[model samples]
Target: MLDDFDRVLAQARRGSPEAFQSLHGDLVRPVAAYLRNKGVTEIEDVTSDVFLAVFTGLGGFTGGQAAFRSWVFTIAHHRIADHWRREARAPALVELTLDDDGGTTPAAEHHALDALGTARVHELLDTLTPDQREVLLLRIVADLTLEQTAEVLGKPAGAVKSLQHRGLAALRKIVEPEGVSP
Candidate 1:
């Protein structure tokens, strides 16, 4: 899959519509999932924006598949931050309440989230700083090597490694409260 991604990115760089489509198809779900985890309820709209940013910025790209994915995610991070800022400045909306008739409400979203590990894992991920979260996601979820993650983030490999270490340590604290074995 990684090799295919490299080929698709190379072809897409040369302006192959089919290759770009293939790449988009491959990436949309994961990217959307990442955004959704970031608290963006409008996943479809944000996903569209992310892809549009990717397409527009593709010409300036100078790395391989890993780099490309990182770059796309970088754009997404910025977009999420922008959305946060906008929301912060906006006036608060009135809260609406609905009466509950003692019927069992649906199971918590956390219940179904174990497919990605425990809901606790996702909660721990949210505890990481943005830089740490980005490096961890790109490395673990996207399966990019440290060097590749660095390339995508436009950072040195050492920095990516440091971030990954810190992020993993944080996750370990949550996952293994007894403490990590040496």
Candidate 2:
């Protein structure tokens, strides 16, 4: 399946419409999900921007599939950075209170509790700087190796390891304040 993507990307670089369509179909959902996970509310808009940038920059790719994926994500990272810069002047987000309305009884409370736990994980991730988050996601979620993550972020492997270590430590502080000694 990925081999097909490589072929499509090559064709896309030559301005092939069919290849572009194939690539869009392959990537749109994952890209949107990635953006949403990164706290981009207008995921569709940003996803479109990422693809547009990918299509425009396809000619610049000098490596294979891994490199291409990294290139696409690098574009995504830049777009996310731009979004943050534009919104930097805006007010910060205030954490919301979760009150159980009578509609959600004890049974529903369990589900809500689970959701709250998951939300806490995401909230913790939100605390990291973008570079740290990017390296963390690429290493953990995307299951890329440290070397691959470094290549994607255009950073050294040692730097990627340092960021990952710091990011995980921060996540541990949020997820397990009792300490990881156990």
Local distance difference test, each candidate: 0.77, 0.78
Show the colliding residue pairs in model 1. none
After aligning candidate 1 to the native by TM-score, how far in Å is the CA of 41 from where it should be?
Answer: 3.1
TM-score quality measure for candidate 1: 0.67
What candidate 2 gets wrong by more than 4 Å, as runs, is 88-118, 126-131, 169-182
Q: How much is the lDDT of residue 22 in candidate 1?
A: 87
Best by TM-score: 2
Error (Å) of candidate 1 at residue 114 is 7.5
Against the hidden reference, what TM-scores do the models get?
A: 0.67, 0.69
Error of 2 at 108 (Å): 9.4
Q: What is candidate 1's lDDT per residue for 1-182, written digit by digit as tens?
A: 45577677778879899988987887787788777666776678888888888887777887766667767777876777777787889887877866976777666765576555645556777899989998887776656678767876789999999999998888777767657452
